[model samples]
Target chain A: MSTGLIFAGTGAILFAMGVAGVMLLAHLLRRILAFNLMGSGAFLILIGLAQRAGLVDPVPQAMVLTGIVVSVAATALALALTRRLHKLTGAYTLPATRDD
Target chain B: MTEFFDPLAWLILLPLFWASGAFLLGPTRGARLAIVGVAAQLWLAIDLAVKVGDGGTAIRHAVGGWGAPLGIDLIADGLAAAMLLLTHMVALPLLLYARGYFAADASVARYFWPLSGFLLAGLNALFLAADLFNLYVTLEIVGLAAVGLVAAGGNATQIAAGLRYLFATLIGSGMYLLGVALIYGAYGTVSIATLTPLINASAASAVWIAAALMLLGLMLKTALFPFHYWLPPAHGGAPAPVSALLSALVVKASFYLILRLWLGPFAPLTGTIAWLPALLGSAAILWGSWQAIRAVRLKMLVAYSTIAQLGYLFLIFPLLGPDGLALQAGGMQVVAHGLAKAAMFAAAGAMIHVTGRDAVADVAGVASRMPVSLFAFALAGVTLMGLPPSGGFLAKWLLIDAALTQGQWWLVAVIIAGGLLAAIYVFRVLRQAFLVPAQGERRHLSHRAPPLLEWTAFTLAAASVLLGLRGVDLLRLLAVGSGP
Candidate 1:
């Protein structure tokens, strides 16, 4: 029970940190890392949830695996877009305003 | 053989299949495949609507022949069918317009076919999704396709916009996945129908947290109020048909998820955070419309107008408290706004094609140069402004009727005020179009858009108007299923 509590708590904290990072950070790379952090946090929570069930639940495990794959794809695409933006604009951060 | 005939699987699968083909085969052959695939999708959607409307029962297909709960299930009732009708109807014309708009040598053309097809499949899957986790997967598909389409412009600003959009959507979906995990951990199942009875008042905190997380995610994707910062830049920067799709369908996908959750698995928590959506929605309407009125770019104005239009959808949450009528009113509003917005974007795109400018003032002489495109824009504006003989008018009437019956006079005021605001932004362009510049030389300099492009936009605009008089069919279709 304590193990379950620790893992779930840690997962929630990591997820919250990701959300904050994405919201507060301006740099594009930091935001991408934050997104990945959030995904990992969510996956940790999924794992912790299965642990709490007291038996290894295959369903949440399957879901976590699928989630990892999706996370990879999203991160890859985001990085590609970021690269394109940096190449075109010579900046790794989004402009503070929409005006060009 | 029986499984092969299922439209639900085909609806979600065929476009994905064709998208792969479009990519592997290159654009020349790929564009043709997309045209054929979208046409087939339209046919399939119409067939499903006709069959389901007549049968008065939803059609369900379990993938891999697995039943609900054990494996993924796709269900399409009246709501799903109507949205499908909206999506495919808008897509068909946009496809035709795109055929003319893009030069053969443009690199973006190659990507458009595959990305659009992928987006379509994802949307259909989202509408049909009965499983929460499945909805997440489809959401990712739709989100990625949308970001890809936005980046098709391949410029600095457009890429920045796409990157920002990707971040916003990913965070939203990530929160949603966390919520799904919580719900599954608590309920032991991820299917909405299965969890409907399982989720009760006993676990109100868990349900509340989960619902809040999911709703937050969806609202972010849908660009409600402050979250709408990512929307205009992304939508405005995309090429025209892509803009129409993103504005018309992609945003609606997330909103549809919100509706599904509210009415389905999260039904137990109906009273939880209900008023918040409506409050935020009211703010979105006023702020968005005001911004639209002040916007200089034509596409930006239209994008802001979307934010305003989305506000009315949230009004249902508050009004649904007293009367079930508000739910239908909201659905009707969805159909109305979706059609009108798509038409508006398409016509604006055609105008930009001729004038080679995206600013409302810069395109002043386009009115005379391309009367059909301008007329299409004007007709679509009627619907956006909620004028008579337009579907927007009918939708607002329903919503007002519901609010009045419930003694929600404040909502009535908000509705009217929103309409007036919509009229202001819409007419801001029409007023520009009406300006007769002394120099007629500019008209000669502008290129002529093909009739196909003008007529495609016109048909969508005309349909939104016609939908006003003939909304009974759609309303009847919406009435299916034991609903809120």
Candidate 2:
């Protein structure tokens, strides 16, 4: 396959894997990791598409870069709060049930 | 070059400028500043509306002075301007309500105000954004601010819920970005205006794939039907005002984007696949209503009602054709629901904060104790149930009319049934408030909650009633600059 097709296929695989990981992973942090994985795959597809068009537009690149930073920031904050929850309860907490 | 002042920029900058001021002054000073900020922004929103009303359609500030596809652009169509006005108006009362509401810590006062301003800024930016990528960035800013607000509660459940919300939002954003990439690759540009002219049946496979991915991503973000798993916990679990904002305005912003895409870039492709959202919408209406009916917590019931109401939004898709009457109904539903539901959530917050309980059974004798709050809640419920002289009634009237006119009476049936379901849940609260229970003595409360919060809820609920009167003008605005 051509490089564009190869990259697109790889992106699709990564997307699938990320989705499956989100479903399979029991831990909140792992699910977050899966989310990032899906995000990276999306970026990869965008990059692959840019390369396919044969002109490296700075716009999509800039957007993806911004996306990466945002994902990291959100993940960091989520991780911090999750850690706090674990510390508080001595158990890895999910969402509160209706019983609460 | 400058015939008139570009009013759209004010829509964006007013809140942003205020946010910076709020940040500079710190939280206590910032809280005071937020009041002024929201007021100023509301004034600017009014100004934009007036200009748009007179000029027919407001389009200004071509990014870098270039046209579509070549550079970014900002256009304030009637729908956008109206939404801007609504958001600013809502934000004004909400900021007033926020003042002194959080007495737990001074840090909360600080963190919350700046984030609210930022949220306003991001919302304004999202409404006015012309390009997909630009919309994505603005959404991120909005999303992060929202997550911060969710986490600001400083409780374990709240934090855990915020984390879940954060993860879901991140995934949605990522998916949206991927869709943008696909569109950019296919069309060689990401501008909505540019794509509107270019997108057609002959468009590349990538375009169709992009549309699907984008819709899927948005559906997840908007919490439509099967994807609505994220909404109840997040909206129900957040603090009262935060829940109010999330249910009222934040989710509406993304839904607005979906409407934009449907009307703009994806108009031609509707007949081929428009059934998708309609089908999903039917499910949402039924499923959301079912869930709401069963929810024990007041907030959860309202949250699920939001999911069901969103279904009404999607019903417009299959109905809009040459005359586009159905599309107009959808627009009205957007405004009506936004007003009514926001009012309901805010009133619920006020009630919960007062009584310290969310269970329906626990709210006995609240109506006598907090008459204004209870009255506000009932008034908002009137709109939700599609009672007369309310925006919800007008919207449903339009929708049912369209359904009958098109011979698609099933949608009409769904709407009627959904409204009935809404009445069931709403009356559940009302009955609990009004009916005297056996156990409790009448306790007259000393500390009446802030008058501003009560006024805010009443004003919002009243707006839903008012929207019915002004529906004609808003509908006219929605029609501007868009071809049937």
Candidate 3:
């Protein structure tokens, strides 16, 4: 019933949804979004579960900050790659494996 | 703070320092700096290994004078030092080879130096990290840097492969972060030294879940079969030197984390699940070798062969016992595979460079024109096939001995079968190289490979074979500070 528990529950749900989205979705942009959602969910769990006992912990908070920065870098890299792929192939999804 | 003199710190800082310097100096100027930086790293690695070997314990340095539980720590045990030594040894020659390989392409070289520097920095940091959160951060650094290197080629296939690689790496690290969070929530500490005694077989369900999550994440990153779909394209599609780095060193970084965890904090939880990785490893050997045998492209064959070689590293997990034979086998496999794979990829790059083609069919009669590269490839193939007087052979000998002592008959069978399967793929490439081209088909002599490229590849391949003769020293080093 505590707030921290509630946040943790929502995080678990978000993580599941994100994983499913990543697996089922083929569009590159949507996959990136799904990846972000997964990051957010993990961050939420990190903060929420640390505070589940009603004690404030700065360690997980610090970790979440670091995680956010890393996620942003990854997101930017993914987006840049997606942009280049789109420009070259004119497709949002990856093409099927070609016979070389 | 006196630990500032520690070589472990320099093993990491030297790479970052040169990486930044290289980025500022531009593409054509970084090669010398990178070579010098890696050479310094090699010396430092040797120094740390000697220290650890003589001291009979791990060297621990707490950053900023803050000890574990409140601050980060770096520990260089025998395993870490061995890996560091291998990293620098492999990287030094590869840097030289890359200088020749990328001589004509400034655009790729521009990013290649900084990215590879960052990659090496991340790898050293990952090896020395003594905590879960630190490991996660280092993993991200290594992953992102690798993806950037893959994408540096700036073509459709390379970019697409890079993107897929980026997604897989992100997911892998994301899952690892979740595991770290769960561990923190359960134990309030992330330091490996502190958590070692706290995590037991009877720990709470959260600890179990965390172990599963962490193991799965690392497995994905290591490209242990079934999760290997992202690896071949990323490794195969990149430029030659880039492919060499990715296949030879990058994947092994994640596998090192897995081995570290299994030996340290997760030791108690590994009893029931020890067979899982080995089972998957057996599958990888069979599947990966089959794929390599069927691969059309030369680099793809080498890349797929990397997957098969990596599977051998996992086979030791099931045979782990008090004698530490399996551990020695794992270490030997890692170093041997690293040296041979680097040589193989570098040689493949040279062949492709000369022929201006990537297909296996295009390499016909390359032996007559490029004897040095072909000899390098065949020597590396000798190691890959686990022939006598090669490090691969010694590693397999130890692994089979361990399995026999443990009475694990199936593992013995898998090891032998894997070796035979490896022979098929290796000879397939060699056979193609020795064959004459079809009549009237003109040989495409697109470009000549520099002597530097051929010599570097040969050096690495020769080192791999030489290790089999002098492997006792490495085994002695591996024995330091390795126990409960």
Question: Which structure among the candidates has the greatest DockQ?
Answer: 3
How well does model 2 score by local distance difference test? 0.80
Give Cα distance to truth, residue B65, candidate 1, Å.
1.1
Model 2, residue B408: what's the lDDT? Answer: 90
Clashing pairs in 1: none
Local distance difference test, each candidate = 0.86, 0.80, 0.90
Candidate 3's error at B260, in angstroms?
A: 0.7
DockQ of predicted model 2: 0.58
Worst 10 residues of 3 chain B by lDDT: B438-447
Which residue pairs does candidate 3 place in steric collision?
Answer: none
Instruction: Work out the TM-score per prediction.
Output: 0.97, 0.94, 0.98
Query: Is 1 or 3 the stronger prediction by lDDT?
Result: 3
Better of 2 and 3 by TM-score: 3
lDDT of 3 by residue, B261-309 (tens): 9999999999998999999999999888989889999999999999898
Which whole-number lDDT from 0 to 100 does residue B437 have in model 2? 56
Q: Candidate 3 — which residues are off by over 4 angstroms?
A: B438-441, B444-447
Model 1, span B1-484: residue lDDT tens: 9898899889988899989999988877887888899999999999999888888989888899888767788999998999998899889988887877775436888889899999999999999998999999999999999999999878887888888899899989998999998888787789888888788667757667888899999999999987998999999888888898898889988998898888877777777667788889899999999999999899999999999999989988867743457777877788888888888899998888877778878767667777898898888888888889888888888889988887878888888999899888887887788785524666567468889889989998998899989888888888777374
Tens digits of per-residue lDDT, candidate 2, A20-88, equal 776567687788788778878888887777775455677667768877887787778778877877876
